[model samples]
Target chain A: MAKVYNFSSGPAVLPHSVLAEAQSELLDWHGSGMSVMEMSHRGKEFMEIIHDAEHDLRRLMAIPENYRVLFLQGGASQQFSMVPLNLLGEKKSVDVVNTGHWSKLAIKEAKHYAKVNVVASSEDRNFSYVPAEDTWQCDPNAAYLHYTSNETIGGLQFPFVPTPPEGVPLVCDMSSEFLSHEIDVNRFGLIYAGAQKNIGPSGLTVVIVREDLLDRALRITPTMLNYRVHADADSMYNTPATFPIYIAGLVLKWIEEQGGIKGIAARNEEKAGLLYHTIDSSGGFYSSHIETPFRSKMNVTFRLRDESLNDSFVSEAKKNGLVQLKGHRVVGGMRASIYNAMPIEGVKSLVHFMQDFARQHG
Target chain B: MAKVYNFSSGPAVLPHSVLAEAQSELLDWHGSGMSVMEMSHRGKEFMEIIHDAEHDLRRLMAIPENYRVLFLQGGASQQFSMVPLNLLGEKKSVDVVNTGHWSKLAIKEAKHYAKVNVVASSEDRNFSYVPAEDTWQCDPNAAYLHYTSNETIGGLQFPFVPTPPEGVPLVCDMSSEFLSHEIDVNRFGLIYAGAQKNIGPSGLTVVIVREDLLDRALRITPTMLNYRVHADADSMYNTPATFPIYIAGLVLKWIEEQGGIKGIAARNEEKAGLLYHTIDSSGGFYSSHIETPFRSKMNVTFRLRDESLNDSFVSEAKKNGLVQLKGHRVVGGMRASIYNAMPIEGVKSLVHFMQDFARQHG
Candidate 1:
C-alpha cells in the first residue's frame, strides 16, 4: 500500500523486521505445527519465548540481579493505581512530582489509597518545563517518591531523577522514554513503562521492580495486582499476554540485531536532533512548546505561528505520506513521536515536510 | 522441518488457515502500513479490529442483545478475584461447586473477597465425576452461584449448569471448553473463558456478562478490574491485547467459514466420540478417570490399566508425531486435549496410534 510514516504517539511504530519475522512464523512456529498464539504458555516452546524475552530485556536495560522484570497487563494506567497499592501500604503519605497530565492523573489515582504530597509541580508554568529536582520536598517517612519521567501528553521530561530523603524509595513512570536510552536500573525501587510507546505493543506493560519492594502490599491488594505473586511466578501467575510477549520478544531480538539499547538510543537521539534543529532554525515560523532543557527526545512538540495553517499542514502532510502529525487534544499543536522504530529517514522526511509546510504558510 | 502435533491444553491448536492469514498480514495489516500491534487503540484501524471481533464473537456464540462481550487481560485466574470483587459487593455470600483443581482455586481466591459457600463438591469422589446440580444448596439471597463447567486438570465437566435460586445469578467458568459447542447464553448471568484453550491465545479472556451485572463492584476495586469500564469502552478502556484480538477475530472468521459454531460443534462431537470409543472399546486395557457423563469433549483423559505403559505411551506417541500427551502433574494419566482446532484426521491418526500401542503393550 501506502508508503507512510506513523506518528500516533503510542501503539506507535515497531521495527519492520520484527513484524516480518513474526508474520513468517505465525502459522507453524519453528515447525511446531502451531502459531505462537496457539502454543501453551506452560509448554516448552512458550517457556523459551518468555525466558529469552525476559533475559534480553534485562541485559538491554542493565537491570540488577535483585530486580524482578514483570510482563503485566492493564498498561501504565493500571500501574498508576497498582504502584501506590503495592508501595504505600506502610506509609500513609506519598511524595509526588507533578510534571504534566499523566503525573497529575497518577497522583489522582493514588489519592484513593494514600495521602498524596505534591512536592513540586510545573503546572503553574503550564507544564512547559520540568521542575528542577533540587526543588522537590520529599517525605522522609514516605513509602516512596513517585514521578513521571516523560509525560506523553505534554511532551515534557525530567532530565534527571529526583532524590528522595532517607528510607524513601524513588519510583518513575518511564512509559514514553524507556529503551530510548540507557537507564541506571539500581537508581529506582520501581520503574514501569507501557509498551505501546517505546517498547513492543499496548497490551503489555513492562515493570522493573526491586525485590525489596515486592512484599508489603496492602491486604486490599487483589491477588492479581500483587507484585510478589507475579515476580515469584515469573509473570506467569496467570497466562500472560503471549502474542504481545512473542512480538515483544521479536522486537527485543531486533534491538539486539541493532546492537542493543545503546545503538538504538544513539539513533533515536540523532533522529530527534534533526527534527528539533529544523524547528529551531525555523526562525519564529515554528515554535516548540517545552523549554530546551526539558524537551523529549521521543516526542517533539511544536506549533505553527499561523493558527489556521495547522489544518492544511496536517492534511498536506498526510497526502505526502506522513500520518498522525496532529497534536494531542490536550496540547493543540503538532507532535512527531520519533519512537524506537522511527528511522532517521522517517524523521528527515518529517523535517522536510515541516519545512515545506512552513514555507507555504510563511 | 519436523512435523508434530501439539496437544498442550489452552493455547492449544489454531486452524492453519487462520495462521496463514495472520502471517500474511503481520507487518502491514490490510495495507494500513502498520502491524495491528503498532496501531493506536483509539485509532480507527484498531477500533475496527475490536468492533469486528466483538461482532463476530457475538454472532458465533449467539450472545443475546443484553449481554456485553468483554476482551480482558490477566486470564481467567484474574476473573476468579474480579468476579467476587464486582459481583459480591451487595451480598453476604456466594455459592460454589467444586469439581477439580481449577474450581478449588477459584473458590480459594473468591473466599478472600466473599464468604464463599461450597454448594456441592465432587472432591469427595476424587474429582472423577461432576457433582449433580440438583444436590446443590445455593442460598437464595447469595450474590451468585459459580461453577467450573470443565475442569482442566481432573478432566471432569458438569453435565449442565445448576439452576440458581431466582435472585441468585448463575456464573460458569467455561475457561477450558468455550466455543466447543452451542449454549443458551440467556441461561447464565456471566460466562468467561480464557482464550488459550479454544479461542485464540492467553492474555485475552472473553467475558460475556449480562449488562445488569456491570455495577456493584467493591469500592476498592481497581478501575481496570471493573467490568463497567471495559463494557463502556467496548473493551478498549486501556490499550487492548490487539494482536491476540486480531487472532481471535480471525479464528471467529474461520469458525464461520467452517459453517459457524453449530457445524464446528458437530465436528467436535464426532472427534470426541471417536477418541472416547477407542478408550471404551479397549476392553479394560485402558481406563478413564471420569464417569461417562462428565467426560470432556475437548480433553480426553485416560490411562492404561498397567500404568507402567504411561511413559512408553507418551514416548512412542511422540515418535509418531504426537506430543504433549502427558497429563497434569496433579493428575497422573495421559490427556489428549483436542480443542476446536484439532482436525478429525489428527484424532483418527491418534486413535490408530493408540490401537497399535495397545496391541503391543496389552
Candidate 2:
C-alpha cells in the first residue's frame, strides 16, 4: 500500500523512516532476540535503549544537569492535574495564561487543587491571538506561571515565551509544538510534551523538570503523580510504556539525522509555510481564523470561504490520499497538522490540492 | 535472527504472529495510509480497533453487561492508588490479603487513603504459599477485599479467589494472571491487569469495573484516575495508549484463535506441569520453593540445590537461545514464566534443557 499523508493532531504522524526501521527490527531488536516490547525495562539491552534515548534527547534539547527528564505514562492531560498537585507546595495559587482549548483544559484541572489565577485570556476574541505578556495579571506570590506554548484547536501560538514574575517558575505545556524548534531550556522550570505529537507515540509523555521542583508535591498527590518518585527511579518506578519509548528513541535518532532540532524545525517551517502560503494567497477562498502573528506552524487551521463545501472538501482530500484533514469539532474548519515528520512533499501536495479545490469551487 | 524464549516476568513475550502482523502493517495499516500509532485516537480506524479489542476481551472473560471495560495507562501501580481512592467511597477501611510482593506494593499505596485490614498473609514463609481462605479476618464493614491473584517474584498464587465479606466488593490485582484462564467475572467488582503480562505491552492496563462501582470515587480522585470518568468517555477522556491498545487487540485476536480462555488455560497448565514435573523428578537437583497447589502456573520459580551454579545455569540457558531466565533479585534462583504466549515447544525445550543441566551439575 502506498503511504498517504496523515494529518492527525495526535496520536499523530511519526517519521516514515522511523517506522521503516522499527518494522525491520520489530521481530528482533538488534539481535537481542526479543522485540523491544518484549524486553524487560530493567534489562541491559533496554537500559541502553533508554539511556541513549535520554542522551539523544538531552543532546537535542541541551537539557541542563539540574533538570531530570522523566519518561511517563499518562498523556498531557494527566500532567494538568499533576502540575498543580506537585508544584503548588506551600503556595495556595498558581498563575495561568488561558490561550485556548488546551490552556483552558489545564486551567480547569488545576482549579481542582490550586487557586487558579487566569492571568490573561484570548477567549474574548474566540482565542484567535495570543495576549501580550504585558497584559497578563500574574500574582507575584503564585506558586508558578503556567501557559500553553501552542493551542492546536484555535491555531494560537506565542511568538515569544512569556516571562514569569521573579522567583516564580515558568511551566509550559509544549505538547503540540515541542521540539518543532529550538527554545531556551532554561526558560522553563518544567516542560512536558505528550510523545504522540512531535515525538514518537501516545502513552509516553516526556517531562523535563528542574530538580528543586520535584519535592514540592502535595502530600495528597498520588504516588504516581509525584515527580520526585519518578525522578528518583529514573522514570522506571514501574514498567514504563516500553515500546513507545523505544519508538521515541528511534524518532530522536531520526531527529539527529535530520540535523537535530534546527534541521527538523526548518523542515517544519517549510511545510507549514507552504500550507499557510496557499491559504493566504487564495483571495477570500481560504481564511485562517487565527491572527496572522499567532498562527501555529504545527497545526494550520483554515476554513473554506464557502462553509457548505466542508464535506466535499474533506471527502475530496481523502480521495487524493490526504487523510484526517477535518478540523476539530469545537472549532469548525480544516486543521492540517504538519508536524516534523510530515515531509515537504506532503505539504506541497496539500497546497496543490487546496489550489485545485479552491479553483473548482471558486 | 532466531527467536529466543524470553522468560522475563514482564514486559514479557508476545505472540509471534501478532508481532508479524504489526511489522507487516507498521507503516500502512490496511491501506488506511496511517500506521496504527499515527492514527488519531478519535478517528474511525482507532475507534474500530479499540472496540474490537474490548469486545474480544469481554467475550473471552464472559463479562457481564454491568461491567465497564477501560483501556487505561499508568500500569497496575497506578491502579493500586486508584482502587483505594475510588472504591473507599463512604467506608474508611479495606481488606487485603498479603500474598507476596505485588500485594505489599498495593497495600503500601492504599494505606495512604484507607485503614488497611490485613485479612491474611503468607509472608512468614517467604511467600511460598497462599493463606487458606478460612483463616482470613475480613472486616464486614470494609469497602472491598483486595488480593493479588498471582505473585510472580515469590511464586505464590491463590488456588481459588477469596470470598469477600457480605456486601463488600471483591477487588483483585490480576496483573500476572489475567486472561490466562477462565474465571467468574461476576465475583469481582473490579479487576485490573497491566497489559505486559499475559496480554500485550507495558503501560496499557485493562480495567474491568462493575458499573455500580464507577460512581464511588472519592472527591479528590484525579479525573484521569476516576473510573466513572473513563467509563463515561469510553476511556477516551484523553489520548490513550493507542499503539499498545492496538497490539493488545491483536493479542486478544490471537487468544481467540487459541480457543479463548479455556484452551489457553489448558496450554498454560500443560507447560507448568511439564516444568514442575521436571523439577520434582530431578532427585535433589532442581527444587521449587513454592508449596504444591499454591504455585503459580504463570511464573514457575525454582532453584538449583547447589545454588553455586546459578550464574552458569543462566549463561548456559542464554547460549541455548533461552534468555531472561535469571530470577528476580528478591528471589535468588530462576523464574521461567510460561505465560500464554510461550508456546508448548518453548516449555518443552526449557524442560529438556533443565533436566540436562541438573544431570550435569548433580
Candidate 3:
C-alpha cells in the first residue's frame, strides 16, 4: 500500500501506532476473548477501560477538582444545544462572541433556547480576525458568554480567553485548538471539543464543565443531554462510545509519552510557522484570509492569487500522496489541518508541496 | 489465555471472524493508510465505509423504501426520551405496554415529555409473562402505542404484535430481540435497538423510522435528538461513530455470509432449544421465572431450586470457560444470552457445564 497523509480537518489523522494496537486487540481485548466492541458496557472490562480513559483525560488536562470531564456522544453540534439547555436556567439572555463559522452556528442554536446577545463579532472582516474584547457589548446578568476559541474553516483563533462579566461564566468551543495550546482550567466555566480534531475519533465529545454548573438544566432537556445525569454517572449512565474512548485514551497516553501538552504546542507552533512563512514568502501568489495575529496554528487556510489554478493544484498534490487539502465548501480554497498526531515530517512535506505548487502557479 | 465464552447480555459475544478481520485492519483500513477511526467523517474513505454499512443493513433487514435507517449515538437510554420528543408532537398522551425493565424505563422517560397510558401491563405477574394482546386497553387517540418486544432482564418476550387502536402507530423496542427473529417491517412504525447485542457495538443505535413520522418533533427537541434531522441527512449531519459503524457493517457481512437473518434465526432457535431443554430435563431442580410460552429465545433466565447452589454453579461454570452468566442486577440468578453471534458449540459447552453442575447440586 502506498503511504499517504490525511489532512482533513476533523476525524482527521491519528498515529499509526494507536491503530496498530487497536487491531491487535480487536478479537481479544486484554485476553477477554471478545473485542472491546463486543464486550458489554456493564461488564467489568469495559467499565475499567472507560474509567481509565476519563481519568487519563482529566489528568492530561489537569482539570480542577471542581470540574467534571464528560465523555459524551453527539459531536460539538450537540453541545451547542446542550450548553444553553444546561446553563440557561433563569437567565433570559446569553452573551456570545461570534468569531467565525462554528461560533456563529453555536449562537444560532442558542437562539432557539435563549435570547442571544452578540457581544462582539469579527464578521465585518469576513471572519478573518477575532474581535477585540474591549470593543464589545455584553450583558452583565446574562447566563453565560460563549465563544469559539478556534474556527476551523476561517483559520482564526482567540489569542486569549475573554473574561466573563462579573459573576458570569465564560464558555468556549475549542474544537480545533483545544489540546494544541495551554489553557487555564479555572478561567472558563465550560470547554468542549469534538474528538475529530485534536482528540481521537469523530463520535466522542470532551466536555469540561464546572461542578457548580451541573444542576441548572432546563426542564425540557433530554435526560441523556443533561450534564448532571452524565456527571453523576461519570459519563457511563448510558453505553458510551467504547471503541472511540479507548482510541482517545491511547492518544492521551501518546501525548503523555511525548511530554504532554507543552511538547505538542511547541511542535504545533513550529509546524504552523513553517507553513505560514512559506505562504507569506510566495508574495501575491498565495494568500491566507485570517490575519496574522489571529491565525490558527492547527488548520492553515490559504489560496492561490490565481484562483483558476486551484483545481490543478489539488489534483497535482493528490498525485504526491497529500490528500484532503481542499478547503471547506463555505470557503473555497485549500486548508492544511496539522493536528496533534500530524508529525513534523508531514508538515515539512506539506510546506514542500505548497512551495512546489506556488512555484508552478507563482 | 484461556478461551472463555462470554454470555453477558449485550456488549455480549460477536462473531470471532469479525474481530479477527477488524484486528487485521486496525492500523490501515483497506490500504487507505489511516484507521477508520482516523478518517474524517466527510472524507470519501470513511463515507464509503458508512455508506456500505447502511446499505448492508438495509439489505439485511429488507428495509422498506418508505422507512429510513438511521445510525445514531447515545444508546437506548437516549432513545427513551427521544421517541416521545419526536413522535408525540403536541399530543398529551401516549400508550405503553409494561412487560419488564426496559419498557418500564421507557415509560418513565416518556412521562417526562408526555402523558403516558398503561395500555397493557404484565407487572401484576412480576413481569414473568406477556399479557395477551386481546386484553390490552390501548387508547385509540394516543399518538403511538409503544411496547418492548423483548425484555433482556426478565427473559420475557411478547408472543405477538398487538394491534394498535386507530390513529395510533405501533412502536417496538426490539433492543433485546432484534435480528434474533425476523418480523414484517411493515408492521412497525418505528423499531430501535442498541447494537451491543445482536448487531455491532453499544455506541450505535439503529432506528428504522417511517417516513411519515419524521416531521412532527416538538420545538423543544434538541437537533441531535430530532429524527427529522437524522432522516434528512441520512444520519450524517454531524460526525458519526465511525468505528462502530465499520464493526457493525462487518457483522452484517458476517450475517450475509451465514445466509442472512433467516439462516441465523434458525441457528439461534436450535441453540436456545438445547439450553431450554437442559433446564427442563432437570425437572424441579431448575426452573425459569418467565413462563414457557413467553420465555425469550435470545436471553434464557433460570434459577436453581436451591439458591445456595447459584454461586457454585456460576463459579464452576467460569472454571470451565463459561463467563458472564450472572443475571442482571435487577433480576438475579443466571442468564444465557444467545445472540446471533453465539455458536452452537458454545451452547453445547454451556449445556455440558450445566449438567455437570446439576449432577452435584440436584
The residue pairs found clashing in candidate 3 are A39-B11, A40-B11
Question: Where does model 3 sit among the CAPRI classes?
Answer: medium
What is the iRMS for every candidate structure? 1.5, 0.9, 1.4
Ranking by lDDT: 2, 3, 1
* Tens-digit lDDT track of model 2 for B1-362: 97599998999999999999999999889888889999999999999999999999888899999999999999999999999999999999999999888999999999989999999998898888888788999999999999999997887778897788788999999999999988999999999999998889998999999999988889888889999999999999999999999999999999999998899999988999999999999997988989999989999999998888999999999998898889999888999988999989999989888988888888
TM-score of chain A of each: 0.98, 0.99, 0.98
Q: Lowest summed-lDDT stretch of 10 residues in model 3 chain B?
A: B158-167
| Residues A290-315 of candidate 2: C-alpha lDDT, one tens digit per residue | 99999999999999989999999999
Report lDDT per candidate. 0.87, 0.92, 0.87
Q: Which segments of candidate 1 are over 4 A away from where they belong?
A: none
| Alpha carbon deviation, residue A353, candidate 2 (Å) | 0.8
Q: What is candidate 1's lDDT per residue for B235-299, written digit by digit as tens? A: 87877878778888989999999888899889988998999999999987888989999998888
lDDT of candidate 3 over B1-362, digit per residue (tens) = 66878888987788988887877777778988777877878888877888898899888888899999999988899899889999997688999999989999999999988999998788888999988878888878898999999999999987787789776888999998888777888888999999888888768899999999998899888888999998888789888888788889999999999988999989988998999999999977778988888989999999888988888888898888898898888988899999999889999999998987888777
Worst 10 residues of 2 chain A by lDDT: A2-11
**What's the true lDDT of residue A153 in model 2?**
81
lDDT of 1 by residue, A249-362 (tens): 888888888888889989987998898899999998999879999999888888999878889998899898898888889988898888999988989999898888778778
